[model samples]
Target: MSVSSLALAQTLLNGALLGCLFGSIALGLSVKWGHLGVADFFHLSLTLLGAYLTYSLVTELLWDPFLTLAVTVPAFFVVGVGVQYLFHLIDAQPFTTLLITFALFIVTESVVSMIWSPDLLNLRPLLADGFTTSIRLPDPLPRLAVQPIDLVALVCAALMVGLATYALRSTRAGRAVQAMRQDAAIAETLGVRVLPLTLAVSGLAAATAAVAGMVVSLRMPLTPTLPLQWIGVVVVATMLGGLGRPLGALVAAVVLMMIQNAWSLWFPPQWAPAVTFGVLFLFLALQPLTRLARERITSGRTA
Candidate 1:
């Protein structure tokens, strides 16, 4: 069976929107692991909690969905800082950080399950007719469906990535973050308050996760185990783009997600996941050769 051009365009559009959501989801992990050297797997758990909280507020308290960010963002920022402080207390090594965060992820998941009962909750009821509202492309192009929530996720992703890129490039704290990444001892010697900077970054990372979570609830349902499903793609995007590179992660996620979505159009749905990991594997396989080529180029220049 042949697919229509319009169908393909619609698929691509959905992929792009979902890609932004996934990219935003991975940002917290990217920032924490990339800059601070803390893997912080609990970041996803915090997102799940945020999504559930948003659902509760929208359903129980009759608050607007977007307004939920006002609560989740600050709350999760504090949670992120507290978790970072615990890491500081332990002098968390790479392996230990991973293990500790994994444990914390489990604990947080348990808390959410107990509170929310592992149910699939969403803001659909609160959204009413707004959920189905779509933007139609003008004539000369096939009509493509776009949801308000999708635009919300895309905007949030762009803002988070842009703000992060700007902060890292234009702000003093960003330079200190870069310095710490290069050498914490040197940055500290240069009078950078390394500890406070890390706490602040951690808080920001958690805030992004909260924003991501609220965006997610606007689009999808929340379940206690949802993070498990997300962890793979998020990690792939994070590693593919490298840690601390939010913009890179977003680009990687969008590309990977689009490819995966395209694959589903022609191939079995079961094989769709292979498209994602296969791309990652291909990149990993090429990375060493790319590194070697760069080294040779540098050597030739020196010669």
Candidate 2:
């Protein structure tokens, strides 16, 4: 197939927008995994729940879709706290939280399936056609363009990253959360109140998930279980971005999307995933080895 320059530009733009969406979806995962030290399998389910809530309220009650965040975020925040407390009650090890969260994921998925049905669900924005409007730049390819919705998603990604970065860096609670991330027992010894911090972090992550789900629903049609597709995005972007760093995830997402789209252009779409994962595995594998080598070199020099 002959690829037009305009078409390629459009493709790149789509990738950029998708990267933002994926980053936002993965932000909660990064938080819970990096800081809380919990294998939060239910993170995507929280996002899907947010979308379903927004769709139901906006469609049935005629409320503004974004306005639904007021409801979804807080509710999910409480849900996060409750789930965290349940984990605490079970005295589950950090790794074992993976199994607990998986159970939660299954339950949330079933609830969504029951309430929203197994069929496709979508949110209708007020400016549906307006979002589709693309701009043309004067040049060799006048039609090399992008939709406003993509830009909106990019902006939202920026805001989410910035907010998360600031929260983790500036606030006392956030600092305690970070402390716990580094070492839960050590943080507790320092009076960080590990459980409370865990609950707070969990709640904030869930609220972020709600925002991500809302942004996602705004951009495309969705299904109750579509959040599952986000697993790769969450894992790859979070690992690429660096654990516990929202800013890293944002930049990584953009880079990942750019590379993935470029690879797709020169190869079969199926091979693109192989390339994407191959790169991720190589990157992940090298990280620890490089760190170990650097530490050994430092020790030798000191000796």
Candidate 3:
């Protein structure tokens, strides 16, 4: 393959694969903001927390960081439940909740800095070293390169998607969660255990964040502040993907990453934040018209 062709192929493949990371990163925020109606500005902090916890445990106990999920997931679950209860107690408006979460994030970030100091923490998991795999193409195609860490992340993301689908579509508790998401009063009137279900969903969200962070940490260095950038990526993805639809969010995440990959060719990767935000701005600007068109189409179909 020609240089340009190979580069294009790599670009497309990475964009798509990288989106699994993106979608997973946003899963926690998606559940909270998209499903639970909590626009949690500090959702990214959960990822940071997950990364820090895994790193701390691995360093302290000499265990595979991957093995740390047994601890991280449960710890974050409890944290989420506690946070959700606080939100309920305050009966915070959306904007206020955003502020509250952001404040909590600042506090958490400070604690992390105090413990870990101001340094970029990167790890080369024993599992990821020399973990490259290549597949030969049959005649008209170029060989493709793959990484184990990325594969692990992709598999994890796919599993999360499956679990999310089953929970939202096939379970009674999931239905009640969705019902509450759409209208809390109506869901409660329908005998949905709104409080318990909300706590469960919030806990699920935090667990997803932990998984996302653990995967990303395997491939890169982490820091207390690193999740700040992730916030933009995941939030843009959540909105683009369809706030309340997990599968839709994954598809949208992939599409957005594809566009960002294209943008990267023109500019440095650092501009990714700008690219994502720009795409989100355009999407939001057009959302009202899109919603109206959809409503009209629905009415037409029914008529």
Candidate 4:
């Protein structure tokens, strides 16, 4: 229970909390891009919008962090719907959707700069006063301190992911959405409304993004350029997590964060992201080989 050990433990806890926040944002992207066959390249813009809007409402109207959700969640959902409708109108191919959404990301970032003037903004912590508490460690050890707000955020993210997973598994609508993701034509023939289902899924994804954005705003400073940073991390998380699995996304976020943090401690800051990307590349290269091996084993068993 040395002071250095205590410090390292606290840092790990903090990293886990931040990792949850990353997963929260990635969850929506996983659903949209992984499940629904949407490119959803603008997820970062949606997050930045939520963060910026939360900051504005909290600062101007004296809204609480929770209350800001009333404004942000619905607004982002509507935006999601509108964006989907626009995409439908364009009738873009999958790669085209990626290009289109990336373009939208640029436009949204520009809009954010125009409205917020590229300034950094942060919301007041929701539980500013009672957020941090200390607990005594054993004798000859430094006391441990925890931030309740960070813990709360982590718990909330876990709950949201659990609820979403349950909904997808247990509800008729959720099952229908899943079916559509696999085969839209077949699902449509089976009485699923593909258009409405896509809209609902997109809205849900955007709502989750809004929640993540608000939490991020409370925890860190926001800027117009922040969305680009989130996009890069989220893309990596989504890929490493196997695309559609929320749990996988959570695990990937933690792994990536740990790698980055551990590397940064040992090497220069510039090398951290490179190290992380290298690890991700290795994972990506192995995925298809692993899948092929599984498929061959299954076929041999059948034979």
User: Clash pairs of candidate 1?
Assistant: none
Off by over 4 Å in 3: 1-3, 125-142, 291-303
lDDT of 2 by residue, 144-257 (tens): 776676777888788988988998999888888878877878989999898887888888888888988777777777786786666766778888888888888877787778
Candidate 2: misplaced stretches above 4 Å?
1-6, 124-128, 136-142, 292-303
- TM-score of each predicted structure versus truth: 0.96, 0.88, 0.90, 0.89
Compared with the true structure, what per-residue lDDT tens digits does model 3 show for residues 1-303? 234767767787778777888788777777788778887766688888788877777777877877899998998899899999998999878888888898998998998899888698866644434544444445666466656667777898899977897888889888887888889999899899888888999988888888987877776787788867667777888887777677777777888888888777767878877988998899889989999999999999999
RMSD of each: 1.4, 2.8, 2.7, 3.2
lDDT of 1 by residue, 1-303 (tens): 798888888898889889999999888889999999988789998888888888889888999888999999999989889988998998888899899989989998999989989778766766868665887767776477788789888999999999998998789989999999999999999999999999999999999988998888888878888988788788899999888899889988888888888888989978887778888899999999999999999999999
Q: Which is better, 1 or 3, measured by lDDT?
A: 1
Colliding pairs, model 4: none
lDDT by residue (1-303, candidate 4, tens digit) is 234665566666666777788888888888888777776878878888887888788888877777989888888889888877777788767788888888988999999999999877656543356543534445654565546656666876797788777877789998997898889899999899998888888888888888988887777788888876666567788888877777778778877876776555556778766776788788879989999999999999999
Q: Report lDDT (Cα) of residue 246, candidate 1.
A: 90
Model 3 quality (TM-score): 0.90
Give the alpha-carbon lDDT of every model: 0.88, 0.81, 0.80, 0.78
Clashing pairs in 3: 122-221
